[model samples]
Target: MKGQSYSSISFATPSPKQYSETMLHAQQNHATNALRSESKIIPACLPTPNPSSPNFASRFRTDIVQLVETSNIHKHSDTCYKYWNANRGDKKTCRMRMPRKLVSNSTIDPATGDICMRRSDPWINNFNDYLITACRSNMDIKFIWSGSDAKALVYYITDYVTKT
Candidate 1:
């Protein structure tokens, strides 16, 4: 889907307190080592910077960039083309729909009321800056804008919960 922007997308930014608490909790739980071992993205366990610190903005941005580069960048695998069917003339496509179209800016569609969030990178999964920084893990965040979207999310959650 070249040049196709997402129909509805939004990112919720966590409050400073929320961010700080989450980061503090993560540090207290010793999740840094686990994150390092799992992704090796972080070179060392860095203390969570205070919001008011002079270097907090730079440090936070650096951490988010590193985490996103390590975990949010999408790479194609066999599963990406599992539904490909040359016989049916179906072009190979990733089920998770990686390599999404890049959006220049966030806007709401006048006719459809769909929100298209700005996306500069086509291969990076949707993420929230605060979430990835606080959780230090891969995450996908999207806004539910329509009834269909809400229904689909509910079904997916239910299916996952009921899975044997």
Candidate 2:
């Protein structure tokens, strides 16, 4: 990661043998290290954070917002509690938000006579591209979660993939 101190920290799953070895080594060598301990160490099999090159905080926030938007798109309003309706400004869309008509980077719809989501909006276009990729893909989607079966992947990138 640039503009920061650390390098890339991979979250690739560690084998069971490697895990046990790491645990044993940690116990023998770092028994007194307060910040790090066996308990705080996440298993390599579990998903981990990917800190980035710049301000991870800002990028992380954006990522979270995108994830919520994706969720709202896939799960719809009643299904997800944190669903953020990306098309909130337009009444024609499923979700509605912000009552202001004088928003910047917006245009008045001739039909509705209200400010509507423009075709040039980056947010809408990016989400549309994501939707297309998710829907048209042929491969099985792998979600890092607690269970190994289909039931565990409720919020998967796509609702479902191929063979579980």
Candidate 3:
């Protein structure tokens, strides 16, 4: 993980691929800050320009997060957003954000155990290269599997996206 990049988008859930050993250390440090354990969103010392900052590219796209949060839920299904494969028989699914009561929803295939995400889904991946030319940015936030922060993750997520 020495040369690898990390997400600066606050409330971002570091995808395992992008975050390997560095997060392991960060996870260990969570005991120091109990909130980190609950949210799995640590206050990393990553130094970079943030998209939410004033310098963010005004031309950069913001519709991806919009489609997920505000668009018609029915129309924003995995298929509509192109985040899932209807042809796949197992057809497991999950969401970056879900209704508070619908906590058990998984954007993964139960049978296949594969993450049901589309490579094309902008909101589902790190935006480092695509969104910023210099800053290492990652907007694709993974969900916290458990902890007290689970209840408040949606609120934090809104902040993360809107800041972008």
Candidate 4:
């Protein structure tokens, strides 16, 4: 029998558009974590002037602010926050944060997947921008342990948002 050609098989890889969209979505979500954490009532609020700490909450807040100011809009879907004071007796954490809203496009349509910015809701932009900025400052905080105990204070930040 003749040798089989490698071209005969097909593998599913995301297209450029899909890849870009995915990266954007991830960046947006991470960026917004800061704002969401701040806005959230749980874990208590931090004191004013916001100390330059590497803590989750501090970094979280800074990230959201950056995303909003930067002119970068990624994939966004309808999402909402629902909190219940009704504590689950078993768990230590009483507060429950759930997504009460649906995940839809900028312009929601049953049959069509067209995103019309002009006709879409206004809150979408403001809220999303907030999120992106928050996420940028909050994700992948495995630094501070990466370097030696030398004099130089090293800080790590992701400038290019790309997928592996």
Candidate 4 versus the native: TM-score?
Answer: 0.17
Model 4, 1-164: lDDT tens per residue? 01312222111122244335444544555644555455763222332223364343433334333332243222333332133233544432312122122333334244543322221222123233233333432221111222241212332123233324
Predict model 1's lDDT versus the native.
0.65
Q: Write the per-residue lDDT of candidate 1 for residues 44-154, one digit (tens) a residue.
A: 244454678654554454465557667878899988888899899998888888888877668888777677777777777888776666677778798889666788899
lDDT (CA) for every model shown?
0.65, 0.33, 0.37, 0.32
3 against 4, candidate with superior TM-score: 3
- Model 1: ten consecutive residues of lowest lDDT: 1-10
Point to the candidate with the largest TM-score: 1
Give the number of the best model, judged by lDDT. 1
> What is the model-wide C-alpha lDDT for candidate 3?
0.37
Per-residue lDDT of 1-102 in model 3, one digit per residue for the tens?
A: 334343344232223343344334444444333653466552332233356754233212222222222221222365543566667654554554432132
- Checking candidate 1 for backbone clashes, the offending pairs are none
Rank candidates by TM-score, best first.
1, 3, 2, 4
Residue 157 of model 3, lDDT score: 75
lDDT of 2 at 58: 33
**Model 2 TM-score, all chains together:** 0.19
List candidate 3 segments past 4 Å from native.
Answer: 1-18, 31-33, 38-123, 129-164
